[model samples]
Target: INYYVITTFVFQSAIKLALFHTFWWMFSQNSHILFHEMMRKIKYARIAFGHVLFDDT
Candidate 1:
């Protein structure tokens, strides 16, 4: 009975850790993609602004 109880506890903890790792991996991947998209947009905006300023001059 004691062994059964210990095994169950260990199984539950292992499942929880796996789930946490999956969630964290997904979150990081999504954030990395978002950051890249934001950087691209900022770069484009800066180029456009520079062109406009040059045109004005």
Candidate 2:
């Protein structure tokens, strides 16, 4: 029983890792715009939250 559970968990983990890796590869290769947008949003959010201590304002 324990062996079966271990095997099942390992199999699912491998599948999830593979799927994530493939998706990341596709995103990295095809669309940099989404990545850039996410970064811009993060920057804005930091500024809004006052995480960035220095600003021209």
Candidate 3:
């Protein structure tokens, strides 16, 4: 009886862990893409600022 209970518990835990890992992976992927886009925008902003300053001079 204890063995059956333990097995059931383990199976449930495994399923939960798998779901959590999948969610974490998806969140990380989205954050990574957002970070890259932010970096690109910052790089473009810096270039624009430089051009504006130089053009003024």
Candidate 4:
């Protein structure tokens, strides 16, 4: 019984650590992609607004 409990505890802890690492890695990757997409949109918006302002002038 004691051995089984110890093994179970170790297995649970290992799975938790692995899940934590995977989630962290995924979060960082998603944030990086989102950041780049936001920048691209901002750049495009600026160019579009500039054209509109230029036409009005």
Which of candidates 2 and 3 is the stronger one according to TM-score? 2
Q: Which 10-residue span in candidate 3 carries the lowest summed lDDT?
A: 48-57
TM-score of 3: 0.47
**Clash count list over all predictions:** 0, 0, 0, 0
Q: What is the lDDT of candidate 3?
A: 0.60
Q: lDDT tens digits, residues 1-57, model 4?
A: 575576557656655665565566557778776566556655765665466446533
After superposing candidate 4 on the true structure, give the runs of residues whose Cα lies further than 4 Å from its correct spot: 30-57
Clash-forming residue pairs, model 3: none
The residue-by-residue lDDT of candidate 1 on 5-27, one tens digit each, is 76557656655665565566557
Candidate 2 lDDT score relative to the true structure? 0.57
Candidate 2 per-residue lDDT, tens place, 1-57, comes to: 575576557656655665566567557765675566556655655564453234334
lDDT to native, each model: 0.60, 0.57, 0.60, 0.60
Give every collision pair in model 2.
none
TM-score per model over all chains: 0.48, 0.48, 0.47, 0.47
| Better model by TM-score: candidate 1 vs candidate 4 | 1
